[model samples]
Each structure stands twice: as structure tokens, then as C-alpha cells.
Target: MPKVISNTSPILYLYRIGGIQWFSKLFDEVWVPEAVKNELRAGKIQGYDVPNPADYSWITIVNPKSMPSEWLALDLGIGEIAAMAGN
Candidate 1:
């Protein structure tokens, strides 16, 4: 399977619906930026069924080296910034 980079919303919904395993079935590994993981943490606090992102073996958290000023200028959330910046 090819590498899979994911944003936050899809993950949030999938986790809430108990369909997170679909990620594993579709991809050998899933790469999410640190921002995505942070969003997941926020979801967990909101009583969503978000698993601890670090506990998943197939899910890798990557920190973006740099974020473009242009992307930041868009005023998007961290998860959007990370995904757009190719984190």
C-alpha cells in the first residue's frame, strides 16, 4: 500500500463511528502530522471515542519542518495548516 497522509475531520468521524480499523485495512501505514494528533486529543476531551494517537502502531505522527506564512495567512486551523504544508 502507498503511504497515506490524513487530515483531522475524516479521522474524527471514523473514530467516533468505530470505523477506525478501516484505515488499517486500507493502508499499511497512516501518517498524520502532529497537528492532527493534537486535534484528536481535543476530540477525546470532548468525549469523542478518539483513541490515543500515540498508541496506534500504524499511525505515525510527523512534525512539519516549517509552515509557510501564506498558509498561516489563510487563518486555518493547525490540522489544516499541517495537511496543507505537507506535514
Candidate 2:
């Protein structure tokens, strides 16, 4: 299925600011990666706040087919990679 491939920036930003519902309103489902999850945890451990959105259910994490490490490899980054793979 063609879905949004979300990342850490938008999730954390929205969460901390308590704007998660808006994310749900904008996309059918918001997705993240393990890398992004790890980053979130690291922020929490470092005493950096996280956006909880405890009641929000639209956000999720998915590991797609492997991708190259460097963003430069793909002009549009991994979201583009996953979108391409969907076809």
C-alpha cells in the first residue's frame, strides 16, 4: 500500500508540542522507523522531552526493505525508496 513514510523530526516535534492529532488529521497513518524510535528513546534518556500523544493511535513504526545509509544516494531519501518499492 502507498502510505506516508514518516520520520523522527515531525513525530517528535508534534509530540512535544502536543500537536499529534493534527498529524492524524493530515495523514491516514503516520509511520516511523526503528532509527527514529531509537532517537526518541535516546532523547528521553537524555532528559529531552518527548511528545507522548498517548491517546493518539495513528502513529506507527515500520521497517521496509533495506535502504542505503546515505541520503545522498537517493535524491528524495528513503521515503522515495519506499514509495518506489510500493510499485
Candidate 3:
């Protein structure tokens, strides 16, 4: 079994399609950065249909100790940068 670090979109879309259970089936562990969790929470707060990571036992939230300077230069979302940096 392998572990995976996921960003907001994949989890969000999969959840929307009602296939979120596939994550546990395909991977031993599914990790999401704090930024990703926050993004989902924000969406939910705004009245969007978003899945809360805490609702899923398979999902784990992690925060990167530090971000790389090179990655910071790129125009990417916080969740995207956190996912890459956490990995």
C-alpha cells in the first residue's frame, strides 16, 4: 500500500461525485495539508457542498514545517503549495 498527499480539488470533486470512499480503497493513507482543509472549510462556510476532512476517517490533515522559496515564486494556491511542500 502507498500513501498520498492530496490537494483540495481531487478530494472536493471526488466527494461531489460520491466516490470519496475510493481514496481508502486505493491508498493506505490519504493526507491533506492544513491549507487544503481550510479551503474546504471555507467553501462549506460559503454554503457550497464541500466535504469536511474530519468527517472522513481515512483523511488526515498535516501542516508543512516550512515552504520552499522556489515554490513560493510560482503563482499557486496555498493548498497547492502546501501539498507539494508537505510531500
Candidate 4:
């Protein structure tokens, strides 16, 4: 089983430092919240980052499901919550 909880900042920061390979080496897979993926793909023409196909492999991109919330609140855009609450 892979670690299904990852935040956008660590992912992005690792990408910037060319350590995404390290992440792949450590974990069989990673999880990205919809909000996190949105943050990753936010800018147009952002060019290739470290996690790009050319740089690393085995890191699959996925849109993790949202949690159940009765009360309408500001979304924090998290991954652990996604993995815990998701299928």
C-alpha cells in the first residue's frame, strides 16, 4: 500500500529541488487532493517541473475525493482528509 496523503507544498517544493525522484523512491504512490492538483496546474504555460514525466516516473496524478461536511466552510485544500474520507 502506498502513502495516500501528500500536501501540495511538499510536492511543489520537492519538484523545485529536483527531489521528486526521492519521493517516488520512498513511496509506491502519492495522493493529491483536487485542490492540490488545481494548485499545481494553476498557471498557464508554467513549463515543466521536476515531477514532469521527463524527470520522474511512477508518480501517478489523481484527483482525490472530498470529505463529507454538513457545514459549509472554507476549504483548506488538504490531502490527508482526502485519503481518509475518500474511497
Write down the TM-score of every candidate: 0.82, 0.66, 0.95, 0.59
Off by over 4 Å in 2: 52-55, 69-87
Q: Which is superior by lDDT, 2 or 3?
A: 3
Candidate 4: which stretches are off by over 4 Å? 44-56, 70-75, 78-86
Candidate 1 matches the true fold with a TM-score of 0.82
Can you list the residue pairs that collide in candidate 3? none
Task: For candidate 3, write residues 30-58 as lDDT tens digits.
Answer: 99999999999999899999999999998
Worst ten in a row by lDDT for model 4: 48-57
lDDT-wise, the better of 3 and 4 is: 3
lDDT of 3 at 12: 95
Give the Cα error of residue 12 in candidate 2, in Å: 1.6
Clashes within 3 Å, all models in order: 0, 2, 0, 0
- Model 3: lDDT equals 0.94
Q: Is 1 or 4 the stronger prediction by lDDT?
A: 1
Instruction: State the lDDT of candidate 1 residue by residue for 11-41, as single tens digits.
Output: 7788778898789899987888999999889
lDDT of each: 0.82, 0.61, 0.94, 0.56
**Per-residue alpha-carbon lDDT of candidate 4 for residues 1-87, written as tens digits (9 for 90 to 100):** 456456666777877886766676777776555555555665324664524332345645565455667322545555434544544
Candidate 2: lDDT of 9? 72
Best by TM-score: 3
Ranking by lDDT: 3, 1, 2, 4
